[model samples]
Target: MSTSRFLPALRVMLALQTVALLLQAITAGLLLSTPGGRGLHNASAGVVLVTALLYLVVAILVWRPGGGSPRAVAPAVAMVVLVLAQAMLGALHMKALHVPLGVLMFGGSLVQLVQVLLARRAVAA
Candidate 1:
């Protein structure tokens, strides 16, 4: 497939990742106040991980075919790593690190999503 085809896929994956991260944050709040919160948070963690991996895969596809910037790969990799670390921190009950890292992940994912959207507009223009 042409590299351009991967752009749409990449954008979709980034959007998914961003949404998943946001849901994770919401569930984290629920986790603090409700008995069902922990289960929802835990499930959302899996969604975040899956979306990150999908983003990484699309990033590689975009880069490997010489259609996209290699820079995209780095952030995708970082997202995967950050999500894994976040999962571990939560599992270990390290709220101090987990909370801050979750915020960072959500912020970063949002930024990445915006970048991808802007890039698409730039391409279309």
Candidate 2:
């Protein structure tokens, strides 16, 4: 019930999200670079799938405004949207869209990281 308690959970979420995001981003990169390669697309999809699942868990932890402030909610929503888009676009696997999709995932991940850092700083103070 204490704000302090949430700090550790938030930190863990941050680390997990960062790892998952990076993996997914890497997968996207791999796919984007090898559009004609089915093997790479499959591998990328696998990574994206796993990372998305992990991201879901992280999303839950930060689902609500822990301190009753809506500061992190926007970025969280953005993350969710990007996650869905990434999954859908990835499933489609259209070669032309690979780069754009990759960019979206990468940008979303960076935003998530920024949000996590901000949340951590809020807790630290």
Candidate 3:
């Protein structure tokens, strides 16, 4: 695909990642108060992982040494790492770390999404 298509693709992936993370957070809350919460949370974790991987792939495609910024790659990598760790922590029943990491992931994803959207807008203008 052309370079022009990469940005929009990246943006779509980021948006999906952001939404997946948000759903993870919601299901986490459900996990506490509802009987079926655990299953929902577990399923959402898989969705989050998939979205993170997709985001990483798109981020790499969007990165061009001379034309596109490499900065996006770092956070995309971080998201994958964090999501893996988050899954491990959750599976290990390490709430102390898992909870905080989930929150951090959500916040970071939100920031990344905003940055991508702004970058696209800047390019358009």
Question: Against the true structure, whose lDDT is highest?
Answer: 1
TM-score for each candidate, following the candidate numbering:
0.93, 0.56, 0.91
- Highest TM-score against the true fold, candidate: 1
Clashes of 3: 0
Model 2, 1-125: lDDT tens digits are: 23533445545554665566666556546655776555655665565555555555445444454443344445555655666676676567654675676676666666666766686677668
Candidates 1 and 2 compared by lDDT, better number: 1
* Candidate 2 overall lDDT versus native: 0.57
As a TM-score, model 3 comes out at 0.91
Better of 2 and 3 by TM-score: 3
Question: Model 1 compared with the native: what TM-score?
Answer: 0.93
lDDT (C-alpha) at residue 96 in model 2: 68
Candidates 1 and 3, the one with greater TM-score: 1
RMSD per prediction, one decimal?
2.1, 4.3, 2.6
Deviation from native of the Cα of residue 88 in model 1, angstroms: 0.9
Please report how far candidate 1 places residue 11 from its true position, in Å.
0.7
Expressed as tens digits, the lDDT of each residue in 1-125 for candidate 1 is 23466888888999899999999999989998999999999999999999999999999988887576788899999999999999999999999999999999989988988988887777667
